[model samples]
Target: MSVSQPYPQTYPQQGAPAPAPGYAPQPGYPPQGQMPGQGPGPMPGQMPGGQMPGQFQGQPPVQPPRTPTMAGAAERPNLLHALASESTKLWTTRSTLWLLICATLSMPVVDFAISSHYAGLDQVLRSQFTTDSSISALTALLLYVPLGVMVITTEYSSGMIRNIFTACPRRARVLTAKTLMLFVGTLVTTTLLSALSLFVSHAMLPGNFGEPVANSDVLTTAFRCGIYLTLATMFSYGLGAILKRSAPAILIMMAAIFVPFVVAVVTGAAPGSLGEKLMDYSLISGLLSQFNPQDAPATGPSATGILIYLAIAAAAAIGGAYALVLTRDT
Candidate 1:
């Protein structure tokens, strides 16, 4: 082994000759202190500054804030809002205005016509004519029915009911609001028209018709006229809601109001028997009962009876409408 040792090799004096350009210093290959894939020592389960894994090193996690729409519904619905919405719709429509005008004008026009017809009659006949003319204000019910029918039916026809229900999901409340508004509107208009007709009829009456007759009878008739118009309007509204169509609702209302009397007339039913009984329950008869003189009992329903019947009908209609609204598709 000592006899033939290999000669020692020598390198250029430029000393390691600088590493090749663009070469990165390899980790742990040529270096002695560093290990493969290891950086400056960080103890197990600990990062720099003693931070644990998933801990925010510099800033906290961001959170989204609640928006107005996300936080809650915009507002709670109530009767007042419903009333405003309905009243706006009621007044804005051309048909409403026209119907109201017709309703307002009808009583006076009919009274005038009737008065003119009986102008040459005796004082007793003229007084009777005046009384009939005042009661004729109830005829406005024909117009009132259509007005009420259109109020709700038009919404269905135009698809506004979807928007209405979307805004106010309580269907019963919506119906109640509409009913209240319609009642008040119809009452005011009917009352004024009825009063105007009474005034005109009295003014035109011969002096022998006896100083306009401002007794309990006259007051009762006037009050009943307003009540009748209001109730009739609600009745039609209920029918409209139940039917949900304008033409059918109007036709049904007409039949309900007019058909009984028409049938009785066509058949010439006896005054105090079955024919009279049918007439008694007819809508027109119920309304006219309110105008019966204090000395005479009504052949039809009393005022209280009329109110009860109308109330029941309206309730049934509204209840049915509400049920249908909840169960049916838009």
Candidate 2:
């Protein structure tokens, strides 16, 4: 058998034809005439950095995620929205409803008893009607003041205030909302109860006894009683905001209400002295002064003046609370 000869391979000469089209370049190699960092020209509709139009290089332009908005959600919460929120919070709470119901139901029963006793007397004093109506203020001191305290304290206790602050980032708006709600709610509730008490008193008293008092006097007394109770409750609400606790706030409020009167009674503050004037300005004294007959007047500060003073003090306390809320942690 004869051995077959091996075929020899041939090499291409210099300047030979290139590889076929669509062939990938080797690693570490750039396309013809391109720099190290450069790649193939960006595809149609793409920018230099492989980004779409209006996009940055390293990261694509990020848009904030859209959120669903409620009515007025685009707007920062205003006083009216805060007021509506606070009203809903207050009315929805079981404790608030119970306290109001107690205030409403208890007032007429107490007034009727007192009025009947006085009406049976041979001669009833002219101030008795006003006094009977004014009893609701004290009742409010017990029921409504705590209601105000709970308004803030309940949120604190439940850890819900953090969410409230989150929803309404402006702490002052929250405080203002609470104050306005308490003011209006307390005023309306107290006025209605006072009027109801006054009506019951009028029914129990003899027709002749009410004849001397003018209708305006009774209306003025009722309105003033409402104002006082509203201020007192606002004061308590401020205390709650300051302290952030229910028991402590309510106790402090009770002390403010009773301590001055007790001291005045025990020391028998001399008439028209500094002590006497301070005692006169005590909440109890101011409240009693509201029941005085309209014709009998001429005192240092009239009921309205005293109310203004109380209002100033309440505003100051609330202002302090707002300051503290701003400076302190939640």
Candidate 3:
């Protein structure tokens, strides 16, 4: 026993916890210094502590943004560009110009012809115009409502209203633009019609064909006609947007304007029929009756009041339209 034979032996290192059988030091991070089973530190003559640190040791590199297009690309547009675009669309469609031409050529001829045919109308307009002087009298009954159907209902029929709405996303803006376009377009069209009508009337009755003497009032009638037509177009456009259909909307509009009067006429037993007063609330009648222009035939409601009503009706229609588009699927 004095010299023990060589014995197999294994033991833990001093001051270190023994690991379980399969465990090893984690990768990347050394234990405390050079860690277990590692070689000696910075070796001979190495500094005790690391001497220097590199810049941005704890951060990542920043990258610059690269884009194909920048903000405010191309150039801003001007008024001419906008108008040219509008006009291009306005005239490009054969239907638009056709409608314009139709209204232009039709109204004045109908005006002169009807007035000529019914000599009684002239006396009536003169007496009622001078006596009553309401805007309702000047639109010459409700015949103009059907004319308004041509103004915008055709767009509904042809689906051009969608294109118009697409180009003009904001309903009110497009409505405004359309109103302006209607005003301007009808201005030109009616002016031509007026000229043509005057020419024909003078030729027909020469020195007496409603001779437009100093303050003869033809100019007044013509101006009122133009304004009335423009308003009618705008009113119909709003209705088109709301209904997006012609027949039903047309019937509704007609009823809204004419029903009160009809109801009064049909049941004419009471003290001037209670429904007669309700006619004042009619939007179609109000719009068609706007703009008196003193010398023109008189009708119910002053131009100012009629215009106010038309504006209110337009605003309500526009609001309803906006709500519809916002909530609707398409």
Clash statistics: count for each candidate = 0, 0, 7
Error of 1 at 137 (Å): 2.1
The runs of at least 3 residues in candidate 3 whose Cα sits more than 4 Å from the true structure, single-residue gaps closed, are: 1-83, 115-176, 191-212, 269-272, 278-300, 326-329
RMSD of each: 10.7, 8.7, 12.2
- Per-model lDDT: 0.75, 0.77, 0.52
Sliding window of 10 residues with minimal summed lDDT for model 1: 289-298
Give residue 70's lDDT in candidate 1 (0 to 100): 43
Select the stronger candidate by lDDT from 2 and 3: 2
Model 3 Cα lDDT, one tens digit per residue, 232-308: 55566567657766677668767776677567557652534465455544544443443233422233466556655
Q: What is the Cα-based lDDT of residue 48 in candidate 1?
A: 73
lDDT by residue for model 2 (1-330), tens: 999989998888889986447657778787654567876687667787668787767875666898886864777658999899998988898877788788767778887777766755655463467776666567666787888888888898899999999988888888878887888888988877777677667767765444555667667777878888888888888888889999999898888888887887777778666666658768887887776734222445777777898999888878888888889987
RMSD of 1: 10.7
Number of clashing residue pairs, candidate 2: 0
